[model samples]
Target: MSRRVLITGGASGLGLALANAFLGRGDQVLIGDLAETRPDSLPDGADYISLDVRSQQDWDAALAHVRETWGALDVLVNNAGVATGGRIDVEAISDWERVLDINLLGVVRGCQTFTPLLKEQRSGHIVNTASLAGLVHGPGMSSYNAAKAGVVALSETLGFELAPWDIHVSVICPAFFRTNLHESLQGKDIAMEATAVKLITKAQMTADEVAATVLKGIDGHKRVILTDRLGRQAYWTKRLVRPAYNHFATKAGAKLARKTRDA
Candidate 1:
């Protein structure tokens, strides 16, 4: 059966990849992005909606559109987020507010806005895009980690809270991959930006690969989806090998400190 799916941040990167993946499966895909004009790169059959995730007005408009156009929604992917990294002291409060507003509260707003419809229908899936940093919590990434961690926590709670209504929730934790996510990057340290770009560009996985994993996870109704080998390894290492994981984190912190100093 063809399902109605809406993906935020679908103008590019992992969200766009996921949109294409759903379209490939014959799903009716709606791309909700902040772009005023529809992106020319949008795949042939997918529809577009201008949305700013942090705004209640935008979400309300999107909800109205979905109800009018699709009648019912099968899947909602809250993938709109900004990339950020910086030491707590150096990172401005405004940046913290920005990351939290867009990355964490954006997902919250989506859920709050759409839950009524999903509950009424008694079946739906919510996929939230978190990050490995949400779980691993590396140093010099306090704001990003906090925002993504909130997403992870929110997804887990919703998985249980929405279970009675048959609404499934899945949080995606992916390590760096080749994507335009860096375009939204924010930080006080120039070194952090450069490092993020290098890691993203050098990663073995692509957005399409992550999207494939996400599709499988959503289909299987998995609660927590780790999309890369490194992400999975780090998650388990933190859970099973606390001492080793701590050592690795501190070592990475030292390396980052050295890089920052040099820069």
Candidate 2:
């Protein structure tokens, strides 16, 4: 059966990749983004809508447009998010607020607005894009980690609640992937220390690969999707050696602090 899919932040990155993946599978894909220009090379039949996931009005308008076109929604992918990089103490409060508003509350708003439509349909899936940082704290990106962690927790809770209604929820926790994230770093009030920058530069995965994993998780009704081998290892290690992981994080933080002080 062909699924009607709506993806927030679908103009680029993992969201765009997922849109293409679903479109290739013959699903009716609708992409919602704040971008003024749609991607030049989207799938032939894909639909694009302007949306700000943080706004309920935008969600309503997008859902209305989708219903008018597709009649019903089978999947909602809350993929719109922002990233911030800096120590917890040094980052501005506004940075924390902004990241949470988009990364965490955006999912909340999407669910609140679109869930009723899914319930009316009696079957659907909700995929929230979290991060590996949600699973384990890193030296920098405190705001991003907090927002993503909240997303993970929110998705898990919704999974249980929505089970009775046959609405599956899955959270994607990808470590890192090659995307326009660096370009999107503007207006964020956080800057990574040198050591923290080195740590983030080591991840190896592409947005398409991560999107493939996301689709697999959706098909399998997985509770969580880890995009790569390293992500899986980190997830298990975080579970098995949580105290040790905390100690390691502390040590890394100390090292980063030293570097910052020296600079």
Candidate 3:
């Protein structure tokens, strides 16, 4: 059966790719973004709404619109997020707060607003886009890591809570993919170290590949979706040797800090 899918941040990047994937699978797609104009060309039955995920009013309005138009929503993809870079010592507190507000609280708001509707239907899926940063600590992304880690926790808790209502919840943990995330990273108050930039740029997968992984995860009712080999390996490494992992991460972080200072 075709599903009614709503994706936040669907104007571009991984969200847009997910929207297209669902549309191609015969699902009805509603894309919510801050973009002023919808893409000029979209698949049939795909719609776009201008939305700010940080706004409760926008969430309410978008849900109402989806409920009215689709009658029932089958999937909600919380894919909107921002990245931050810098040493924690130098990073502004407001930057951490802003990243958390958009990346973590935004997901909280989406779930809180939509859970009731999803419960009424008794069947739905909620997919939150976390990152590899969520599962393990990394250099130069303290704010981003903290936010995504919160998302992972929230998604896991939601999974257990919503299980009674038959609503499946999944957290997506993708390593790096080619996307406009660089622009979001650039907007951060702190500068990205050359090493960090190189690491991100070396990612081989496209946004479409991550999108496909997300769909497969949802279809299989996976609790966590590690979209690439790096993500999977990082997850297991952390799980198998947490102390060793932390020690290594601490050393790497110190090295990155020295490099940033030297630059």
Index of the highest-TM-score prediction:
1
Clashing pairs in 2: none
Superposition error at 161 for model 1 (Å): 0.5
Tens digit per residue, CA lDDT, model 2, 1-263: 89999999888788889999999899999999996567675667889888998788898998899788888889999999876767666777887888889999999999888888888888899999999989977876788888999999999999999888899999999987777655555433333733334444545778888888889899999999888887887788779988877788789888777866633
Q: Point out the worst 10-residue segment of candidate 2 by lDDT.
A: 187-196
**Pick by lDDT: 1 or 3, better one:** 1
User: Which residue ranges in model 3 land beyond 4 Å of their true spot?
Assistant: 41-44, 186-196
Q: Rank by lDDT, descending?
A: 1, 3, 2
Q: Who wins the lDDT comparison?
A: 1
Question: Model 1 has how many clashing residue pairs?
Answer: 0
* Local distance difference test values of all predictions, in order: 0.93, 0.84, 0.86
- Give residue 130's error in model 2 in angstroms: 0.4
- The C-alpha local distance difference test score for the whole of candidate 1 amounts to 0.93
Candidate 1 matches the true fold with a TM-score of 0.98
Better of 1 and 2 by TM-score: 1
Give the residue spans of candidate 1 off by over 4 A: none
Question: What TM-score does structure 2 among the candidates reach?
Answer: 0.93
